[model samples]
Target: MRQEITSYLSTIKNEMYQLTKFLYDNPEESFKEKKAQDYITKLLLDKGFTVLKNYMDIPTAFHAQIGEGHPKICFICEYDGDIKKGHIYGNNLSTSISITAAISLAKVVSKISGSVIVIGTPGELNGGSKITMCKQGAFEDIDAILISKPHIYNIENPKCPAILPLKIVFEDNLSGNLTSMDAYIMTINLLCQLAKGFKPGCTIENFSISDKVCVISLKAPSFDTAAEIRHQIEILTNTLGELIGLNHEVTLAELPCAEIKTCKTLNRLFAHNLKECGIIELETDKCVTSGSTLGCISNTIPCVNSYISILKDKSIPYPSSEFAKETLSEYAQEIGLKAAQALAFTGLDLMEKQNLIIEAKSELIVQSN
Candidate 1:
């Protein structure tokens, strides 16, 4: 079955390369991925998917469905690029692999008994399309969602915690002869200490301070953990302000952790499929702690966001361009084919092995309840 799926995907090699290259060459920012959306929609439509353009009323978002009946498996794709910095985060690679995988699976969906859904979610960096999709009930009918991402290891689960993106502003005038720069530096140093004191699976990422404003991103394993961290930060900020005679102000925005309620059976099946597809090492390094749009969907439904390593070696750091290149290279095409094979096999298993999907849904119900 894996070889047959690979053969099917091999037939589309040139087209896949063209599609991947075009998207890579013309990167679009969050919420402005019109061209990317149109291209993906057309490709899926050509493969017999019922494409719903501008899905959920988001201009660049779409939901394409192929096949019919019992179990509905979803392939989540994010195409929004970092227009300013190019595909530095390798979203283009993710987007291409997802679309290619979905199409590849669609070719064999008729042989199976379930639907394959490809959801094109735009705006990972700026706009939160998955949040909107979940709120709009996009994932309500889905049985399972598969997401591919670039990472250092083949992680079935990566630590993904509830994230709080907060902006802290020191509003009061500088005390005595102190300048905003001095206050900023002092505040940052103190925050660094606070971060150092944080527990495992909690981190402060992308902390930047300028003038009287400081922006820090927080991630914790759960909502309660995040709330506790937030409270601690507030207390420490207040203490520092009082000590320096400066006023501190904080504004926070919450993002629900796409806490993956793990289904051991499904994970086992995926791991088996991945190994059969030529991947030797499988690690659960941890759950994804980084913020991902997939988190929003996973928070609402049974989803697996698999991270496949692009690096030939795990110890060395590779350039983002190399990652992008890998997504389109011949080797990448093989990886993409394997990914499709894995998802296809998983979907088939979920549809046929009633107990497996039942257990997965039971897990989601337990987590939600």
Candidate 2:
């Protein structure tokens, strides 16, 4: 079965590269991804998917559906790019195009009972389209959601936790003696310490600082930082937020981040299907947990996210273009194909009601515990 998927993927290599290159060449930020949307819709339509353009009112966001009754699954992605960098991450387009591969395999999707919808959500980097989709009564009745990211260690399974994104701003008169560096360190420490309160192993937080230079021009440097807190225990996210006097702010405090609420039934279906795909490989590294990239959809729909090994320089930090390039290697590409093909088979197992439901439930419980 995996071999057949390999062959199927091979035949359309150019299509994959061309689509990737086109998006890479024409970089769009957030909802501005009209071209990317058109390209994605056109391909899905050609392959017999009922493509819905600008799904959920998100300009570049879309949903493509194939197949009939039974279970209704989805493949969703947050595709907001740094227009300034274009394809800085190994022809950048490849990063997004990787999702297209799953789209290209519409035939396999059709084989599964029920519908398989491909959701191309925009503004993941900034806009938070997933938040919008979840709020607008999206993800209702969806059986499972899937995503394939550009990089990470290919985990047969990765831990997933409830994730919450928050923005913290420190506003006070600086006596006119505050630099961006000073502000950065101070904010990082406070945010890091606050995040630490979210229970040790299960919770994780990532932060970014925004410069509100115009507002606090002369008074004080407004160090606006965004932090995302994730935990298997849903209550922990809120408990951590409560621990910090989020309501207390010197200038302006906004709770920009919130963990996604997922559908319980769909989660079990996905877990069962994944286990059947292959022997579930446990990750050795403690930090390596549930797929952060795919977590966007898990918040709303039943989605399973995992990591594919980085092509090179795993030790390096984020925004490492060099490491991103390594992911595009020929060998890496082969591994990706194998992984995708194996995963395709996983979708088939989902057609069987009992096993699929049980597995997903087990996975959710496992992660929660």
Candidate 2 lDDT, tens digit per residue, 137-250? 677677666655555454433444333343344333344455444444554555456555543443324445567311111010011111223212223323333443222122
lDDT of 2 at 113: 55
Model 2: how far residue 272 lies from native, Å:
10
Of candidate 2, the 10-residue stretch with the lowest lDDT total is 214-223
Among all candidates shown, the one with the greatest lDDT: 1
**Whole-model alpha-carbon lDDT for candidate 1:** 0.73
Reference-based lDDT, residue 289, model 1: 44
Identify the candidate with maximal TM-score: 1
Tell me the spans in candidate 2 whose CA falls farther than 4 Å from its real position. Answer: 1-7, 87-105, 108-112, 160-301, 310-318, 352-354, 358-369
Worst 10 residues of 1 by lDDT: 253-262
Candidate 1 to native Cα RMSD, angstroms? 2.9
TM-scores of all models? 0.88, 0.67
Alpha carbon lDDT of residue 334, candidate 2? Answer: 52
**Which residue pairs in model 1 clash with each other?**
158-286, 158-287, 158-288, 159-286, 159-287, 159-288, 159-289, 160-288, 160-289
Q: Taking the candidates one at a time, how many backbone clashes does each contain? A: 9, 13
lDDT of 1 at 280: 59
